[model samples]
Target chain A: MNQTKFSSWIFDSFKVSPEGLGLYRIFCGLFLLFFLLPSAGIYPFISSLPHTFFQPPPGPMALFDGFPSHSVLLLLHTMLILSICSMTLGWNTKKSSILTGVLLLAIKGFVYSVGKINHDFLIIIVPVLMAFSGWGEVYSVDAFLKRNMQKVEGWVLTLLALFIGFMFFTAGFSKLIGGWLNVESQAALGHVFKQYYVVERQDFLAGFVVNINSPFFWECVDYLTVIFEVGFLLAIFHPRSTRIFLCFALLFHFSLMMVLNISFLPNFLAYAAFLNWTWVDHFIKQKAANTEVKSVKHKWLAPVVIALALVGGWAIIHLIGNDAVLQADWGLAGFIVISGSLPIAIYHLFDQLKRWILERLK
Target chain B: MKKNTVKKIFIFFLIFLPLQYAAVGIIGLEKSEPWPAFILPAFQNVDATPEDVLVKEPVLSIVDSTGVIADAVPSGKLFMGIHESQIQGFFRAHFRDSTRWKGKNAEARSWLANRVNQLYPTADPQSVNVRWINRYYDLSSARRRIDSTRVINEFSISLRDESN
Candidate 1:
């Protein structure tokens, strides 16, 4: 590509207004508060394990003694909820986003210390990377108070696409190395079997998927999985086709949820950043023009709302309990987290329909 | 500092992080850390029934100087009402990947020794062995059979001075 094409690839291809960033901030914040936060409930149980079981990773993770005591883990959970609330409300967004990421990373650090690491790195790192994206510049409590607001740079979204693309690339690389391309082996079918037989994750369509004894169908799935993952990096070079790629990813996550009972719902928040939220920013800006920042008079509004969010998060966490957390599969399944995510999915569907109708009329 | 430099850093980072992660993991099989979800294996298994899938269960032994089982480690009981396989992950992470964090490895081994003695009180355990009990899960039958058991690695327990 020429210099101009390369420059446009990083800057022009991924343009997001401040309000778009704010909308994404709201989505991410609420998603973590309502859907993602409850998954952390399992930390108390994992933390309570005998100290002998603690396995810290190499590098910075080695600095820790192990998973903290149950009390400390609960403290981390509380701080996480608060920061998530602050971040969602767009109050001190950068700091709150950073804090939210660090807290979640720390808690999840302990969670992964047990040996198995789930694909939750995307959700954990999004807030940290995006804290620099000026997401809190508009539609936030800080913006209302006229804090240090700035235009949300388009470059950040481009960078995020790169990060997310590389994540998927690694998955494909790992699978290729692990023998997913072998004709004799169907990784997807084998995974379905593993989930069913060993882990016993027979939820949703898992029962039906487990019964399909066709080698051709399973092999096709294996190839498609690798292609979709590996193709993501190459596809992102244009960024115009990102929405199409993201649609495929949505289908991929949904299939995993339906067939294997594995949910990557949290990734939707990360994917939201890549979407063109310019329409949302325009709509919200139009609304804001008529309606003054009325809540500015009510100094307690942010705190009251955050406190209520905290209460809601607390209630959700308790409702999760041991069995619920297990059923939620640490919020990586369609149970607890999906309850919080379904509304957003429904909204997106309606929005897409509206856009299609509008385009037809035009 | 500059916007151009920052962009270069981000670009460089994206390339470096995944390549290094995949390289380390591919080279070091069991010893590698899958932290922060850098690598996604996605089951990478052959299409086989549950029985055909061979799974390894990590087992621990608390033995005396005579190589006799003085008391059971009861690793399963550590986390109440949790799956044994879930608990086995702890053992796998500690022993299989010990080479990465030697200090923590020794610390965990010694702690395991103390735990054994604490439970039995009179076991006088000298060392601990965290080994893999290989088994197969028959997919059609949904049943598991122990194929074999072998000692993977052993660590000497830092026995506390009883007089102290």
Candidate 2:
């Protein structure tokens, strides 16, 4: 695409109103509150809570047991629960989001070092991003009090998109490290399948996965995950592409939920926060009367926006490279990447295929 | 000011109040119990032989602030049993202020030593070895010495049969 066209698209995508931004904040706050309910007392009541619910995983315990007490663990859980609750209620949501993100990161980091990291750990990154996005605008008590409210524009939205995209891209790039490409190391693919199927006891989905057990499948899964993750950077710049990618992500999560019983619901909810609040703002319009869109023509703004996006994208990929750590289970990571990225890829592919068929018929 | 924000905040506080209350309630209920107690059966009967008879005199030890070890009367019996609750009570009362041995493991051994002394006042105290096998945590961090909320500690008491 030409720079002019790219800039215009970027400008249009970021032109979300304060009300729309507020809705996004509210949605994110509510999402965190709801997701955290499981880890609260409600989790023990749930039969499906993972076995590691009551205590830290053995690996984490071995590493963190040296701490003065389990007070830190208890404190982290307590702070997270409080932050989510406060954010949901829109009571000091900004403060809550920041605290929630920090506490969540600390706990997740400590836990990850201990040997078991849940897919939900990535959800913490969303709140960290949202905290800066001025998400406390509408559904929050601050919005009610008419205090510290500010209008958010295209730049904020673009930044959010970039942040989300970077998360995927970094995860993908990390997998490519340590010569995951070599034929000999490609045997690790079989190990991946065995680890997921036998060790993890996820045999229910083993049939679908095992069928694609060839070296070709392994290499494809490896490279595809990296490409799709990094490809998300491109999608974020293209709003239309993002809509397609979002659908793909949903489908990916759905498949993981169905096949492996592992769904990154938090990350999905976080992505939802970055959406242009046109629909929700419209729905909530009757409750308050400021839902009209004001269109403004700024032809020069487009190119600037596009330039910013490109710079942002490069910065994101560079940052990802600096911190990228190769994971032991790149195959599993590949599977996750496929689950997240394939939805967009498949949708786009289907659209292209349909267009080709129509053209042939014509 | 948006009316929706007011409504949302009110609803949030409504939920928060009840959860905070419930958490406090649970923690309060847990604190009411002075200590947790458990009972394990001894390998043999205490009344089988006169040589295995346990003298009722309890030996008092002031050196260890936790409890006094009672000497046991040498009986030819294979095993002896004591009430877990009674042992736990002695440790809780004696070591209520000691800092060094405050956890579940410490409490369990202290209780067992006292119980052993209570059972046999005349027997060699060294013959009775109190080994703590399993540990349980209450609200306290039983594993850590600092700011631990551990409640009940358990221990196993074995009498080495010198006659054997």
Candidate 3:
């Protein structure tokens, strides 16, 4: 636990190739411009509402008397789109990334002002943290602008994992303290019933999950959720265990999508950092060939491409004609695709975790 | 960046672990902390217990911007699937704030009028009205039976508010 040991541990745990980092950068940009940002329409949608509903929860947003004017909100939304584009292209890495985070924070702050806060912390902060991760060292405008690039530091990825783990750990602990363990009451069932009967979010597998009214099953769900969430933080200290926890996280989020209709798939952006993407780069080698040449060619064209995609995404959202774009949560479909037959994946994850525990015990 | 600087940053990041605990548990600011707090509250409480015959639900009546009055839409429908999850907070705060004028909460009316305006933008004039719907579920397990629901408490606020 000495200084050098701690520093080495931090660096070694998160190390990835420059190409890997570059690919991840592109993945983030594409994910935002396509998957997450189109939903940015919701910000203007909410801001355009009456100011009487602008009562923010206790935060910096509470300082504002009312919602900003449509013009101000439109400006923030515009800046947000541009910032995401800048961060994606790795132009002015640190500044653009920070600006992206700040803009998302400000806008989401306005949204959370409407009497709720969901788990958007990771996605909002990833751009800012990755800026410092030296992700810009390769395949970036910053890198292209420089003759020589310093070694990319891997600490930021580890730091991000720490954050993810830390938040999960707190949530898990809070659940345990908040009576999730009570034998008489089925806490998970309570939530299932609420999301089912009360909220009427009964699309997909929600009806199926609700019918299994076994108190035993609900209790097991309660216990396992706490273990998985809390174990995330503890597992981060062990590289192999961290991978196992991340694997469980995939299943966990998919379960949420199915049972409760909550989508945390956006978390993949942060989790992508913990992966060693050298193999992915190798597998996509045919596509990776002369990426630098293509990137240079696309440098001037990237923003234009992004702008088109943004316009197209908004067009589709408006076409849907309601806020159904927000409700449909197309991102959750990624979970279904990744974890095909979610029940089987859950069983597999549990089996693997049990075997892993038994191996360590032996 | 220098290795020393990286190490210092790492230490600072590590320190965040304790700082967060202090902010949430010790300082007890979990509910108030800026931006991201560990607000993943346990879904401990049931929405409505099977035994509890009556469940309270909010119903909204609104005059659209085009001056069409539609009565008794589920309150959650007002937002039209945008963050339907957070309605618990909205319902609790503006509706059931514990008898400071339980059904007659003015903020609740203003909130509804605003949404009506947003939903039917450019309509001549809109009004907001809301009442409670208490209903019961009719199903039983081996031994447990849930009561029927009937909550039609009248707390009608007619707020004519313009969008700012």
Q: Which candidate is the best by TM-score?
A: 3
Model 1's CAPRI class is acceptable
Instruction: Tell me the RMSD of model 3 versus the true structure.
Output: 6.1
**DockQ of all candidate complexes:** 0.26, 0.01, 0.31
Q: Among these predicted structures, which one has the highest DockQ?
A: 3
- Per-candidate TM-scores read 0.72, 0.47, 0.78
DockQ of 3: 0.31
Report model 2's TM-score to 2 decimal places.
0.47
Assign candidate 3 its CAPRI class: acceptable
lDDT per residue, candidate 1, A1-362, as tens digits? 77677677777877677756777787678767755663554665676556656666553566777678878888888999999989988888889999998998888787766765556777777898889888898768899999967667777777777777777877776677778878765667667766665456677788888777666787788888989998888877766556657666776776777777766556776877765566755554455555677544442333334345545665766666634344324443345444444555556556666888999999
Q: List the residue pairs that clash in candidate 1.
A: B49-B139, B50-B137, B50-B138, B50-B139, B51-B137, B51-B138, B51-B139
**Stretch of 10 with least lDDT, candidate 3 chain B:** B46-55
Instruction: State the lDDT at A115 in candidate 1.
Output: 66
Q: After superposition, how far is residue A186 of candidate 3 from its true place, in Å?
A: 0.3
Please report, as a residue range, the 10-residue window in candidate 1 chain A with the lowest summed lDDT: A297-306
| Shift in Å, residue A112, candidate 2 | 3.4
Model 1 Cα displacement at B131 (Å)? 9.4
Rank order by TM-score, top first? 3, 1, 2
Taking the true A–B contacts (Cα pairs closer than 8 Å), what share appears in each candidate? 0.32, 0.00, 0.28
Question: How high is the CA lDDT of each candidate model?
Answer: 0.65, 0.44, 0.65
Candidate 3 clashing pairs?
Answer: B65-B123, B65-B124, B66-B123, B134-B150, B134-B151, B135-B149, B136-B148, B136-B149
